[model samples]
Target: MLNIVLFGPPGAGKGTQSQKLIARYNLVHLSTGDLLRAQIAQGTELGLRAKKLMDEGLLVPDEVVIGMINSALNDNKQAAGFIFDGFPRTVPQAESLDALLAQHDTKVSCMVALEVAEEELVTRLLERGKTSGRPDDQNEEKIRKRVTVYNTETAQVAGYYAQQQKFHALNGIGAIDSIFAQICGIIDQHQPATSESSRQATDEVKA
Candidate 1:
C-alpha cells in the first residue's frame, strides 16, 4: 500500500490537491476533521465525546482521533492506500498513527508538506473566509493563532517523518498547477505505481 500523509498548515491547498492526488494514486481519502464532523453530526458516542471536548476548547485526545481514523481504515480495507489529510497533528499522534498502520503491515510512504509562507496562508484563509463563512477563517487573530499553533505544535510532526526519511517540503506558492506538478513529482518519486497514472492525470488536467 502506498500510504501518504498530506501535511501542511491550514489554507495550504491540501484539500484541493488531495483530490488530484487521490485520482492519481487511487488512494482512500482520510480526513480526520471530516470524519469527526460526520460523527458529530450523527450524534455517535464518539462524536458526543469529541464535541464536549471541542466545546470546552480543549484539544480532543489522540485516542479519540485515532479511533476515528481506525474506523476509516477498517471501512476501506481494500483501498490501494490512503491520503491522510488533517490527522496526526502532533508527534504523539504521528507515533500513534504509525503503530496503527503497522498493525496492518504498512506505513506512511511519505509526508508531502506544502511549505507556504505564513502571510500567504493568512491571505488565502481570509479570502476563503469571505465566501466560506467560516468564522475561524474570518478573523485575522484567529487565523494567526491557528497558524502559530500549527507552526509551534503541528509542524514538529514533520520531524517524526523526517527521521524516517519520508518527509518532503514542497513549495506551495506559484500557480496551482505548477505547485501540484511539484507535489506530483515528489509522489512519483516515492510511489512507483502512480507514475503512469500520474502522468495521465496531469495530462487530463492540463488538457
Candidate 2:
C-alpha cells in the first residue's frame, strides 16, 4: 500500500496536485473536508458539531476526525492505498493515525508537504475566496487565523514524520505541472524498485 499524506496549508494547491497524483497512483482519496461536508449535508450529529466548531474557526475534535478516517480505512479493504488530505492536523492526531494504520499492518509511506510562503498563501486564498463561497475564506482575518493555527499547531505533524525520515518537502511556488513533477520524483525515489518487489513478494505470500 502506497499510503501518502499530502500536507500543505490552505490555498497551497493541494487539491490541484491531488488530482494528478490520484490519476497516476490509483490511490483512494480520503479528504477530511469532504467527509465533514458529507456529514453536514446529511445533518448528522457529528456534522452539526463539526459545523459549530468550524464556524468558530476552531478544529473539530480529534476523535471525530479519527473515527471518520478509521471508517474510511475499513471500507476500502482492497484499495491500492489512500491519499490522505486535510488530515492529521495535530501531533496527537498523527500519533493516533500511526496507531490506526499499524492495526492494519500498514503505515504511511511518505508525507509530502508543500512549502509555500505565508504571503503567497494569503493572496491565493483571498483570490479563491472571491468564488469559493466559504465564509471563512472570504474573510482575511479568518484566513490569517487559520494559517496561524496551522503553523502553530499543525506544523508539528511535519516534525513527527521527519523524525521517521518519511517527510518530503516540495517548493510550492512554481507552475502547477512543474510542482507535480517534483512531487512524482520524490515519490518515485521513496518507493524504488526494491520496495515494489518487496510488496509483490508479500502479496504472493499472503495469497
Candidate 3:
C-alpha cells in the first residue's frame, strides 16, 4: 500500500491538497481531525473528551488518535492506499505509526510536508474562519499557538522521516495546481514499480 503522511501547519492547504491527491492516487483520506469530529458528532465518550481538548486548541491524546487510525486501516482493507492528514504530529506518534504500518507489512511511502510562512498561515486561517465556523480558526491567538506547538513539538517528525529518506518538502505559497504537481513528482519517485503495474491493471479492468 502507498501510504503517505501529509504534513503541514494549519491553513497550509492540506485539506485541499489531500482531496486532489486522493482523487489522483485513489488514496483513502484518513484525517485525524475528521475522525475526532465524527466521534464528537456521535456523542461517544471519547468524543466528549476530545471535544473538550479541541475547544481549548489542545491536541487529543496520541493513543486515541492512533486507535482511530487503526480502525480506519482495518475498515479500508481494499483501499489503494491511505493519505494521512493532521496526524502523527509528534515524533512518538510517527514512531507508533511506523510500527502500526509494519504490522500490516506496509510502511509510509513518504512524508510530504508543505512549507508555509506563519504570517501567511494566519491570514489564510482567519479568512477560512469567516466561513468555516471553527473557533480555533477565528482566533488569531489560538492559530499562532497551534503553529508554535507544531514547530516546537511536531516539526521533529520531519527529521524522523528524513533519516529514512522518505521526506519531501514543497513550497505551499503558489497556485494550488503548481504545488500539487511538485508533490506528485515526489510521490512518483517513491511509488513502487509493482504499484504502477497494479494500478494499470485495475484501470484496464475498469476500462
Candidate 4:
C-alpha cells in the first residue's frame, strides 16, 4: 500500500491538495478532522467526545484519535492506500501509527510536510473566518495559539520521519496545480521504479 501522511498547519490547503491526490492516485482520504466531525455529526460516542475538544480548539486525546484511525485501517485494508490528514499530531500518535501499519506489513512510505509561512496561515485563517464563520478562525488569539500548538506538537513528527529518510518538504505557496505538481514530483522521485503505475501517474501530472 502507498501509505502517505500529509502534514501541515491549519489553513495550509492540505484538504485541497489531498483531494486532488486522492482522485489522481485512487487513495483513500483518511482525514482525522473529517472522521471526527462525521462522528460528531452522527452523534457517535467518539464523535461527541471529539466535538467537545474541537469546539474549544483543543487537540483530541491521542488514544481516541488513534483508535479511530486503527478502525478505519482495519475496515479499509483493501484500499490502494490512504492519505492521512490531520492525524498523527504527536510523536506518540506517529509511533502508534507506525506500529499499526507495521502489523499489516506496510509502513508509511512518505511524510509530506506542507511548508507555509506563519503569516500566510494567519491570513488564510482570517479569510476563512470571514467566509466560513468558524469561531476558531475568527479569533486571531486562538489562531495564533493553534499555530503554536501545531508547531510545538505536530511539527516534531517531521523530524521523526526525517530520521528514516521518509520526509519531504513541499512549498505550500503558488497556484494549487503548481503546488500539487511539486508534491507529485517528490513522491515520484521516491516511489520505486518497479511501481510503474505510480510513475506513470506522476508523469501524467507533470505532462
C-alpha TM-scores of all predictions: 0.88, 0.90, 0.92, 0.93
Q: What is the lDDT, from 0 to 100, of the residue 66 in candidate 4? A: 83
Better of 1 and 4 by lDDT: 4
Write candidate 2's Cα lDDT for 1-207 as tens digits.
Answer: 888899988888888988877877778999898899788889999889987877666788999899999999999999988899888899999999999999988999899999898899989988998997777777788888888888999889999999999999899898887787777767766676535654454344334
Clashing pairs in 4: none
TM-score of 2: 0.90
lDDT of each: 0.84, 0.85, 0.88, 0.86
TM-score of 4: 0.93
Checking candidate 2 for backbone clashes, the offending pairs are: none
Q: Which candidate gets the maximum lDDT versus the true structure?
A: 3
Candidate 2 structure lDDT: 0.85
Cα lDDT tens digits, model 4, 29-144, are 99998888788889998888887777677899888888888889889889988899988898999999999899888889898988899999999999999987567889888888
Weakest 10 consecutive residues of candidate 2 by summed lDDT = 198-207
lDDT of 3 by residue, 1-207 (tens): 788899999989999999988887889999999988888889999999998888777889999999999999899989989999988999999999999999888899999999999999999999999998878889999999989988998889999999999999998898887787777777877885646654554344334
Which residue pairs in candidate 1 have backbone atoms (N, alpha carbon, C) closer than 3 angstroms, thus clashing?
A: none
Query: Which run of 10 residues does model 1 get worst, by summed lDDT?
Result: 50-59
Global Cα lDDT for candidate 3: 0.88
